[model samples]
Target: HACVIQLPFNQKVRNNPDFFLRVIAENASCCYSMLKAKNPGFTLGNRGASGMFPSEAAEWLCYHAFTVKLSNHKVVYKCLLKPLKFCHWGCFKTGALAVLCHMVTVLANL
Candidate 1:
């Protein structure tokens, strides 16, 4: 009995973390197209200029935690979904992200 099924995006993004991020990017009202491509950097706000490819983004999110990189390679959908904010973009009015980023920054300085 499998507890969860994991499927990844290739050519199209749908019904996953990438889908949610896409919807938020191409929201009918806004249509800012925030996610340009899946690269290796932040994919939101002005910093998203160097957007991440979906695959890379998922890997980065899953591996990069508390500024430490994990050795796991095979990532499941649920893992990526847990950390993403479905409708939220960047740190805009998002105190939690701001705090988290601040914490990481402070820790890096130590």
Candidate 2:
């Protein structure tokens, strides 16, 4: 399942300034888990058209995106390693290649 959150350009977010960032920070793990369950190999892509927002809002969104990506990587890394502890070097190589492929896909999408 894909989830999309649309925040209206409203006075509350404008007044609080960091509200959007705070929300993302607090929910990053939840979002990551939800998406990961939907697709274990989930990769984060760029925020297209995010530049259209005001600089402050756009910057905050970028920061939030960074945090979410970091959180997602942490979860994915842990999951990837869990079953590899008993595996041989070849499995490690395969896991590394998978991670590289995921990174390349993300970059390509950007």
Q: Compared with the true structure, what per-residue lDDT tens digits does model 2 show for residues 42-108?
A: 3433233122222222233333345444445454233323222322233233343344355568879
RMSD to the true structure for each prediction, in A, is 13.7, 16.9
Q: What is the TM-score (0 to 1) of candidate 2?
A: 0.27
Model 1 pairs in collision: 38-52, 38-53, 39-52, 39-53
Model 2 residue runs over 4 Å out of place are 1-10, 39-102, 105-110
Clashes of each: 4, 0
- Candidate 1, which segments miss by more than 4 Å at Cα? 6-92
**What is the lDDT of every predicted structure here?**
0.35, 0.38
**Model 1 global lDDT (CA atoms, 0 to 1):** 0.35
Give the lowest summed-lDDT range of ten residues in model 1. Answer: 65-74
Among these predictions, the greatest TM-score belongs to 2
